[model samples]
Target: MRGTVWVASDIHLGEAVPQTARAFYDFLGRARREAGTLILCGDLFDAWIGDDHALRRPPRWLATALDELRATAGALPLWLARGNRDFLMGRALADALGARLLEAPAVLDTDAGPILLAHGDEFCTDDLAYQRFRRIVHTPWIQRIFLALPLGARRAIAARARARSRQARRSKPMAIMDVNPAAVAQALRAAGCDTLIHGHTHRPAVHALELDGRAARRYVLPDWEFDHDAPPRGGWIEIDAAGIRLEQL
Candidate 1:
């Protein structure tokens, strides 16, 4: 996907956040009308135990979100990327939604220029525990075992994991949770790209950095939360010939 590219992530759509889902649906409508290609960077769902569970028996909320995504895909190129929570998303989910699965750390040759894209959690090298947990859960055998379980069992397990994660975050230092500078620099160098765009830290901003005696920019995407928060928040990054810009909901 090139030309005018629109990227968003960390929407975390689920049963609880109807307002957020609605806001995202609206954004999809806008993207269909405006964007040349749309890329959902990651975490489009709060949790995705398995694609079978969602496709076989989608609740009202999931159905609506899927429909919205399908509608958007029908209008333009729609790409989905796996996030930390929705790492289980597979080709089946993308096919069902009429979208294509996008590989993380992908380099896009866009109108603005070539830019590296990622989900961003992999860059949080400061959090040793989370990185260790990430390694365990990402094991192929472990994931297959988890997905083979019953949907209800998977739901219970996911609930417990989420609870534990929230509790753990309460005790962890804030800096540890964000991406490490060294990791970011390494990723940019490895990818041979000067511009990096990602979501997961929920700290949306364009950071200026020096890499190999040259300028580099990292764009962090914001997470969406509209139901309980005092200020409803959501946004996306737009890349075009003009420049890269952030738009808010």
Candidate 2:
């Protein structure tokens, strides 16, 4: 589509993250009228186990917010990517909201330009171990097995997994928590796209890198965190008739 799309990632919505949850809700309200599409890069939820997580007796605010958005978003396209945290999301919810689940390294024709969208975690080549593990967990067979587990069990396992990921982060080098510049260039080269937008490292910056002897822009989207001072930064990459603008409202 030749129109503006709101792009953002690393929401990690839920699990008592009230600030982020509220900001996302507000962002959605604005995007409903502002953009042609809403591209949620990944980690839409802190941890989405399955459809049962959505129907739990103990209603969660995130689930309610999602339902409300889905209803209000109307015909606007909702495109989602599977991120490190909310990889468990599937077609069940997608069908409910008319959302599209994007494959890894998906391409989007933004009003600004043709851009490559990724979760950005796979670009952390410095963390070779995580790369290897990501491959295994991403396989169809493994994903199927995980999806078959009871929702309660899946929820429990997810908590433990997050704790383990935290432990690993504490032990690993700082670079492991960030994207590898070489990997980013490699991905851009393979995708044959200059602009790459993703959110994972939580480092929000516009990086200019050389790809195939040509200059390409890689935008790192910031995660939703309210502890910061300045107007509660981290929103969407807004593109209008003029060009792309980062709206931190």
Candidate 3:
């Protein structure tokens, strides 16, 4: 990007979290004025059962969120990637907001340099149960079957899955939930990039790694939270000719 590129992920916007929605709207406005390109890495919505839900008969909260996204997209370049929670997001949603759909583990040639971007969940290879669940849900045929269901049914199924996922996380070991070192190494090598950017573990930090006799770095994007937290915690990565830096929102 010419001016500046801004990246963010895991907003998890939903009807239940009005404060988060508003905060995101504010962020969009700021981005329009400050950045030339804005990329939402993933999980922009808390639950995206299907694109049809928002395109056909969107609830009030969804409608408002769409409006904000549309405005931001109109003002600047917007690229969205699929997160675990909102992987159902498709071209229909992207078309509606004038945004481009980004594939996971995409490489971006930015002003700073080439960077690898992803939603981050795929690196948690240690979580066998989650990996199995991901395989099932991500299968093309299974996704088609799920999408063919009635919208109400899909919503119910998604809600149930979310509940079960929460329960499972409670009993799982913390280490399993985080990214596996081997998985990260494999991904970076496959992409042929030294820098990796993603969001899913929600634990935001920068890690320096030695890979294939070369130095590499991984940047974890923060998950946005405004309702449950006391002071509201959120941030984004800003990239320019100088370098990339995380800025608090």
Q: What's the TM-score of every candidate structure?
A: 0.98, 0.91, 0.97
Q: For model 2, what is the alpha-carbon lDDT of residue 57?
A: 54
lDDT of 2 at 244: 64
lDDT of 2 at 154: 82
How displaced is residue 115 in candidate 1, in Å?
A: 0.5
Model 1 poorest ten-residue lDDT run: 240-249
Write candidate 3's Cα lDDT for 135-201 as tens digits: 8899999999999999989989999999999999999999999999899999889888888888888
Ranking by lDDT: 1, 3, 2
Worst 10 residues of 3 by lDDT: 240-249
Give lDDT tens digits, candidate 2, residues 1-249.
477878888777775767777777778877887788888888888887776567555367866776755854575888877898887777777776778878768877666777888999988888987888788877989877887898778878889988888888899989777888888888888888998888888878888888878888988888887644555667777655666666555
Instruction: After the best TM-score superposition of candidate 1, give how far the Cα of residue 177 lies from its true spot, in angstroms.
Output: 0.4
Tens digits of per-residue lDDT for model 1 on 1-249? 567999999999999999999899989999999999999999999998899987997999998898999999999999999999999999998998889999898999888888999999999999999999999999999999999999999999999999999999999999999999999999999989999999999999999999999999999888999998969999999999998988877
In model 1, the runs with Cα more than 4 Å from the true position are none
Tell me the whole-model lDDT of each prediction, alpha carbons only.
0.93, 0.78, 0.91
Give the winner by TM-score: 1 or 2.
1
Model 2: how large is the Cα RMSD against the reference? 2.2
TM-score for candidate 3, residues paired by index: 0.97
